[model samples]
Target: MESNDELVDGMIKAMERLKSGDPALNTLASYLYKADHRLYEYLDKLKIYTELEKPTPQQTQDAGKLLEKIVFLLFKGLEGLQSVKSFQSAGPQYDLLVSGDDIGWKVVCKTLYLEWENRDIVIEAKATKSPLEDKQFARLCSIMEHNLRGAGLGIFVTLNGASGFPKRDSTRQRAVSDCRLRQIIFHARTNKIIVVLDKEDLFQLTKNGTLIEILIRKIRDLSELSGLPTTPAEQFQEIDLPTHLKMLYHSNG
Candidate 1:
């Protein structure tokens, strides 16, 4: 039985190899993907165990913290990322703060791009079974609006997705309404953006490595829909993952 530390070490080594442009990037990525799958399995098992044992609230909170750490590690090597830090002192702070260069924003020529040099991204992680509530979104909006650090983006990550919204809405009317509210809040602050990344998005990122681009596209789309100026999606950089790995992962489908 491989320990979690061992698995993480393997992932780190694989990520390093991937960054080095090794020919075996596909193999390494596949291995890392499997490792991530195993991680989720373990988390699921833990959840079952906790259900049976009736874990204390503190124990449950600890489990949530572990999940938060996992997400922080997964985002370590994203392009333009300068640093990722988990907040320790526990009074009214986001779960994670991922600081990075605003290169993508600049590429899009969004308003106030020059002032957005250091892109402080606040991430709120919800590892519980419950979906994210409207209050959480409201809180995130407040933080982004008032925080002196000047965050340009807020990401709300959840295991189940947003509360009161169906996961697969055929009409997309709910999604559009949510995006409109987000756009209103973000633009009211001028140049700020907020997005929700559910478990599906996380899985897609692990499987395809295009999450960053997707996030940028979401921001651009929101800006355009709101009548704000933004660069065309074609102008953004092309960041295709290794073809072999993508095929390998999608082979079953």
Candidate 2:
């Protein structure tokens, strides 16, 4: 069995190789592609070990934290490579203007605008250890549209895996229905939603290259709200993983 130390060392090496553009970058990419699969494998084994037991509340919380960390890391990695500015905006009225009647109320416009090559995106990072409901997902979408009009993208980082949930599962469906593959136009004018599912769901999707292409294409399109072309290669070129990872390591050090 690979010891935890061994795994850590291997991961560090892989990340470094990727940063240096080593020929081994290909291998590292393959490994990352399987990350969700390995995570699911471990989860399945854990499920077997706890056959008669349900995950405790505290255990669920811990699991949620772990998943959140993974999503955060993924975003950080991608952000590093891109040439966009991203920072947490003020508060609820991050963007847009809301108005009531003549003597009514209005939310101040956003600090950022949807200018060419400059897009504003709001990210809501959340975690769930169990099945999620439709109301929760719908609520997220509503918040994005109502408050952030020129918002080009809305990303939902979810843990506790959304797979095994049915399509007819109104809750799961609603969670992502706003951006179905066929409903492309609707997202074009508004925030294109991206649900980064837990490790398990990500793994299953990898079995089909087509699915990966679809997701990349969708994200590419969403990213283009800044007047960029919709291309995965171009998007990645915009990501600066090497520098970002170095900063992360030094900060922790």
Stretches of candidate 1 exceeding 4 Å from the true structure? 1-63, 88-91, 101-115, 163-166, 174-183, 224-253
The superposed Cα distance between candidate 2 and the true structure at residue 88, in angstroms, equals 8.7
lDDT of 2 by residue, 201-224 (tens): 333332312222323434544434
TM-score of decoy 1: 0.56
- Backbone clashes in model 2: 7
Tens-place lDDT per residue, model 1, 1-253, is 9997577565544344232223343233323222244445545544453354556787778767766755675555343456677655444666787655444323222221214543577788886666677777777777777662567777776666665343543332323445346545566666677766665555545432344444654554555443222222233343334787878766886
Query: lDDT per prediction?
Result: 0.53, 0.38
Give the TM-score of each candidate.
0.56, 0.40
Candidate 2 lDDT score at position 232:
34
Clashes of each: 0, 7
lDDT of 1: 0.53
